[model samples]
Target chain A: MKRRAFMLSVGGAAAGMVLLPRMAFAEAGKIDWYTSSDQNILDFWTNVVKPKFEAANPGVTLNLVDAGDAAGQTAIGERALAAMQTKTDPQADYFESADWRLPAGAADAGLYVNIKEAGLSNYSRINPLAFDGDYSVPYRGSQVLLAYDTTKLDPANAPKTFADLVTWIKANPGQFIYNRPDKGGSGGNFVRRAILEANGKDLGKFKIDNYTQEAGDAALNPAWEILKDLSGSLFDNGAYTSGNTQSIQLLGQSAITMIPAWSDQAIQAINTGVLPETTGLVQLQDLALPGGFSRSVILSNGVNKDAALKLADFILTEEVQSAVLSELGGFPGVAWDYVSQDLREKYADVIPTTIPTFPGGDWEKAINDGWYRNVAPNVDRAA
Target chain B: MSLTPASDIVGKKPGRGLTGLLLVAIPVLLVCWMVIWPIISAIGRTLWLPNDGGTGRSFSVETYKFFFSDQYSLNNLYVTLWTTGVCAVLLVLICLPIALYLRFAKGRLAAYVQGLAIFPMFVPSIILSYAIIRVLGPNGTVDLLLNSVGLPHIRSPYLTPWGPVIGLVWDNIPLTVLILISGLGAVSNQSIEAARDVGAGRFAVLWHIILPRISNSILVAVSFTVLGIFSSFTLPYVLGPAAPEMMGPFMQRTFRDLNDPTNAITQAVIAFAFCIVFGLFYVRSVAKNRAR
Candidate 1:
């Protein structure tokens, strides 16, 4: 009798172990948030956002998984797409910094939730320009700005236009630098700004969906010529920094006087003492530099869809959006009217009126590859 | 008469052969599953590229044609080969002397020398790259020293082809020393003493006696160093120049940044083809040693 009772208890316990997460989800559901964001942003989410969000809604847990790199994030997207097709649990609640139109047919198949219509109370506060397609939520934005050391060059004499910037580069050789286009956004947009100038500031010529091989080649030729002309005036005679941080480091090391740097990164560097306090940031006046937004999309097939939607809505509230600026060194997804007056007043000199968007699909690939071939050819050297 | 028969002692027993097979089976299966299958799959993907209309997939060599015909890709391949060759030669040159000292010298200082030689193994490659930049880049420690003495600044290797070469050589020294020291172990001291008694100089003893015995080990070290340096990514990415990158970074940029996986896989397959040559040298040396 004792043996039979023991067998029955074992069976009951095994069933409970299998079904508990599903049955008790309303009481305690863990939202698996997948992201490829930088370490500081992850820290902001973990240390600042997670605690507050979890406390307000006691049962829901925000689990941040640092998906290592771009490839890891892409794999998560593919897995979500696969689960949607098979009508199974995606095991993922949210994906950060994802290209929403990926996995080829994901958009058509409705793999991602329509985030704008997911019952977000703060939906009206989002900047209309940042609200792209409404399939993903744009939480923050970053633009490339001209970062210069004040001691080396006075702020009043800084270049106000792309034309002025070019002349300045020519006048002060080895005093300016930017990273490689393929490596970081600051350099990529510096190249893009040049392209824009080459095309007579015609933004309409470049579109999100419009890039053919022949068209891309013809459009980029003038930009290459412009870059090649300025190559001899650059730091170390056309040597580019490897990435965003390297450009900032060069300024810190007093190796260069000015560089094209991401606004968020430059600000963070100054705040963290990586770059000196004298480093100043300014945007171009004639034409605004292109910027990118970090967007998060919800998986339709997620097991914790309702709770994930709640968290997604919570992310857009003024509280979290304000912290994104003060703590994380990022631009708010909401317009300046919704942000705190102090932040607006403080960053008035550097904040852009409008963040121009650049097509990341095919245009970026063509430009990066062309830069290596036409602009910066290898120079022979002995180690 | 009391002992077991000669056949029982000399021949393999049925259970013993089964145990040997069992012992080797797990690792062999793991290698086939983990390493071999992925390589085959990657090679297969490189061949079946997307069609021109972007509608269907078919077998094609267009990616290979692009890689071979493109000057940029060819230059990257050339840089990778040159970097590997230089790092291998430097590693052998630097590590052989240290190995000989550790092998022949006696005292606590020799132990300390061995410790210092193996120190790089513990430092991560990323940290080593940053340290290299701090010590050797513009306005760095070396430049500051030069300035203090009223000398010219260094032509920094931070963003040149030599940048990755320096980092890789430093990163590879520890393993190279260990291999060389182990190889030097087979050289008995009595032979060296005999050569000394016959009036042979240090160079002659090394060339005629020590080098011949350690030639296989040197080959092993060079082969390992060549393979490691050829596919190295972090050092090359962080330190090397933007244009004409090594094959590792080239493949990565083509795959991730350029969004051209087919071309990236083709680049990888080409690198694999080059690495196989050195791999064969390692295999041959191992086979020769086992025979001896």
Candidate 2:
């Protein structure tokens, strides 16, 4: 009798030990988030978003990881790809992606969980154009604009067209700077606009389904010629800044009068006193600047799929959208009617009636390659 | 000989063999897991093409072929080699004299110079790169100083290869100095003094006695500098020109910016090949020293 009792107690204890963790796991789940976003974004998500999320969904913790060191976005994409290839769950349940990285990263790799299929309610609020085919929910928008110091250059006299900008660059030598095309998207946008002006072709022709070498060569030749001609008039003759931030810093310090900048970044810099308050941004009337939307992605292979979808949906909420605009100086990802009138009016000038998207992946690669081969050498020689 | 029991010798062999196996097993396993496995994986990745969007994967040497054939890629390799060679030579020239002075000279001057030499190691490379840009960029501190002095502001080479070379040398000098100083410690002061007393000139003592003694350290420092500079990304990325970029940043650009992992892996493999060639010298030095 004693032996049977002891055996029974031991069996019960073992069963309890096994079952307790299962219950706890079901009760308290975890959501891991990976992002390459800057410090402000990280802080806002941690301090503001995390607590609210945790409060809304009881017994869930959010873990934010900085996956953007020396490796940058490639490392994050590679890890996601490896996880999919191995048929295993990815390390992070959700990923924060920039506009430029989303298409090549999560969309290309097919790593994102389809929020629409998952029945996320707030997913419908996002603009259909911002959707990368059910892979992402657009969170914020940024527009590439030409920034100038009001003290140095008159806003009324700012160039209204690409041709006028080129003429202005030549007339006011050593006052304008743009980053290397391959280095920053703002500079690349400027180059793409120049191509549009030079080619004088329908913009729709550039957006091809597949990349053809011959088409790319024919399209970029005129652009190379224009850049080569303008090389002599660039800051310090042809010494272009390496990145967007450097160009902004030069403008802030009154070293250069004008440069291409992201609208949100310029506003943030002005707010932070990194740039003078007199710094102003403008979009040329003839040349439509490239603008894109950043998205929140849920990994297809995430361990906590339900929670991940919830988090992604939560990011698209009006409260979070307003916070994105107020805190990050970013435009709302939702339509204008969804946001307040004040927020719309504040960013009215920078916001366009229609956002110009990138011409497709092939054109992007072609521009970078052509610049390296044809335009860069001339720029270097001119310098 | 006396009839020593064969069983007695055989009896101790098992314990001794077990101990030897444990000692060998630990480091062998470590090296296999840490070094060999990752290298094999990276090489495997290069062979298997990444699934680029809708494109399916297949084993091919096309990536390697592109790397070898492309002029831009070739220029990247050349730039890396050029930077490594110049940094190695310049580091040796600068650090050798400082090491000699610190080893032989007495007083606060030597101490002060030694302190200054190692000071850069404390400042982070990212911070140092920014500082270099601030001090040397157009209309920067150098230009400001020139203007203050009522002189014309001169253009700085901060946007060219020379800029990165200067930053790399400044960043690497501390490590080279420390190694060379340690090497100098092996050369006894008495031998140098005795050679001097024997009517050998300063250059002769250096060439004959000190050079031979510290040759291994110099080799180590040069190999390390070459390896570090070849794989370096920060200084080159921040300070070097956009075109004719170093292999590190070029590979990064190819991988991240261009979204071409296959080509990036190929570049990495080429860099790894260079490292292996230089690493052999370090292994040889260690083995030769052990033999001696």
Best by TM-score: 1
Would you list the clashing residue pairs of candidate 2?
none
Q: For every model shown, what is its TM-score relative to the native structure?
A: 0.92, 0.83
Question: Can you write out model 2's per-residue Cα lDDT over B135-222, one digit (the tens) per residue?
Answer: 8877788889999989997866665787889999999999999999999999998998899999999899999999999999999998
What is residue A8's positional error in candidate 2, in angstroms?
Answer: 44
lDDT of 1 by residue, A64-180 (tens): 999866667878778888877787667788886777877667877888899867778877888777877878888888888899999988999999899999999999987898899
The worst-scoring run of ten residues by lDDT in candidate 1 chain A lies at A19-28
RMSD of each: 6.3, 7.8
Model 2 has fnat of: 0.14
Residue A163 lDDT in model 1?
92
Measured with C-alpha atoms, the lDDT of residue A251 in candidate 1 is 89
